[model samples]
Target: MRVSSSIDSIYQNNVTLAQDLKSFVDTHIISNKYEKWHYISRIKSLESFALKLERGGISSSSTSLDDFFACTIVVENSTQIDKAKDLVNKFCDIKCKRPNSNNFTHKQSSSFEFDDLRLYVTIKDDVTVPNEQIKKIVFEIQIKTFLFHAWTIAVHDLTYKSDEINWGKQRVAYQIRAVLEQAECAIADILNLSKLPQLDKNNKETKALNKILNVFKNHFNKIDLPSDLVRLCSNTSLLLNQFEVKENQLDAFLKAETSAGRGTKMLGLSPYQIVLLGIFYQCEDKLLSVLMGEIKLSIKIVITRELLDFIQPDIRKFILDNSIPGIIVLA
Candidate 1:
């Protein structure tokens, strides 16, 4: 589809601005010790903010620039946001001075354009690095959660149809947009949960899930993780059953079979893999239901059982420290 020129500029600006901000933040603060990608590469969650509205340009009827939204990044912790604003102003003002060296005696100033919209990056405190490193290293960054990472996704290609010509309900489109907004809001909330300084202050499930996903994303391609993972889950399953949790045994049975037998081996699930598997599956489920706080102890029970069948001796060792013998599994 032909995009509007104004909207096109906005789209271009959004990507450029985000990268520039990331670059500016990294160079000024992160120090030479850290690679630039290390800070931003881990941002798998940033792509969530992109909005995929059709007619991605201004028409005669269009009124505001928001019509072509690329995405939103929110910082839940107010201190971090304020610091970022300060840094932007500080850096830009200095840049605007051209050849002039503004010093302690004279503070520089410049006209910077950006509306600070508060979202969630989940940082606990508004602490900055040493005065010298303030420019490169930012405490945290929060981005809107979108369905997919790239230019489009199933939600957009299927939902927004201009060429094929399909219309079910006008409200469905609005509902999709609403859900997208909520996803962005929840991402802020999750970021807050991620950066909690004290364990007692943060959302346990969100933190736990994020960590597991990190492990999976980092290692899944390199090695297999289901066999031992299944074995570990066995212990958790038995423990959950002891607590009288009624779980879906069928799911448990399926996972147990899948991981323990030739299927997982054929797929090349590696050694000591239960913890990662259990954590990934459980966390994915939890994150999927972040809007709902209730944990699914029952499904966890099944997944745990599934893990048990695949446990290798080395993999079995991992559960000794993490397992709760009598508590119900929170899958």
Candidate 2:
């Protein structure tokens, strides 16, 4: 494990170059505000470099350090791989490109391999370095997605670096890698799923949920609806259907709700209350008739402020007249 003085000197210079490159990349690439990117960089240790030199039968004088100063850029997903390459193209001089092995299916066996867009690159000429000689040093830049990066980091030591090969551990590691690979592929296509087709159009519950989403989006200009609210909508969609509460009816109700509250106290209601009140106003008689039975348990009650303050004067009478347990008024 002894490293000669010449090799030690070269490693020291490489350490300096690694620091410079790290600073340069931090300033130019990682500072990009558009995409959320993570960076990892490392310089090969002297012991490891010496081992590689001895094992490859390569002399210190002629061997070029391709991996001496290396770094990895973990992107959001596979879709951003090209965008990351474009950013690298801006600052570095690319010498060679290597596609990840994951891109090609292995007909011989089912296996998981390292996924990377490896770019062998050097610093551009215009960029200044401590030593001009270090500019010629070709370091590697690995562009990988979160999943791929995660899989490599998680499984590398357990399987690849293990002294004794345990097939069970290797199998589990590859299985995990396969899952992560599938996830990366899924992420690549997630944004385009809506463009494919309308498979749920015939389903009544799907239609009702769509109606709820559309109504909320149109009225509140909200696309990211809360999970609880969505669940409430789902649970009540069939009820809305049962009561014959059409989309137009909810739209009309919201319009009136908005118009009535512009210059008054209790100016607006929560989305939860809006849906409940719309159903209440439309189906009060039928709801009151079955207020005490199994029908009561099916209703998803979301307790909010007193309904009397928010309702119109005519509807205020409805709230006053009906002590409908957990319906229009909870108190």
Q: Score every model by TM-score.
A: 0.22, 0.63
Residue range 283-308, candidate 2, lDDT tens digits: 66665554544355345454455544
Model 1 poorest ten-residue lDDT run: 36-45
Best by lDDT: 2
**Sequence-dependent TM-score of model 2:** 0.63
For residue 7, model 2's alpha carbon misses the true position, in angstroms, by 3.0
lDDT accuracy of residue 10 in candidate 1: 48
Candidate 2, residue 107: Cα displacement in angstroms equals 8.0
Go through the candidates in order and give each one's C-alpha lDDT: 0.37, 0.67
Best by TM-score: 2
Residue 12, candidate 1: Cα error in Å is 9.9
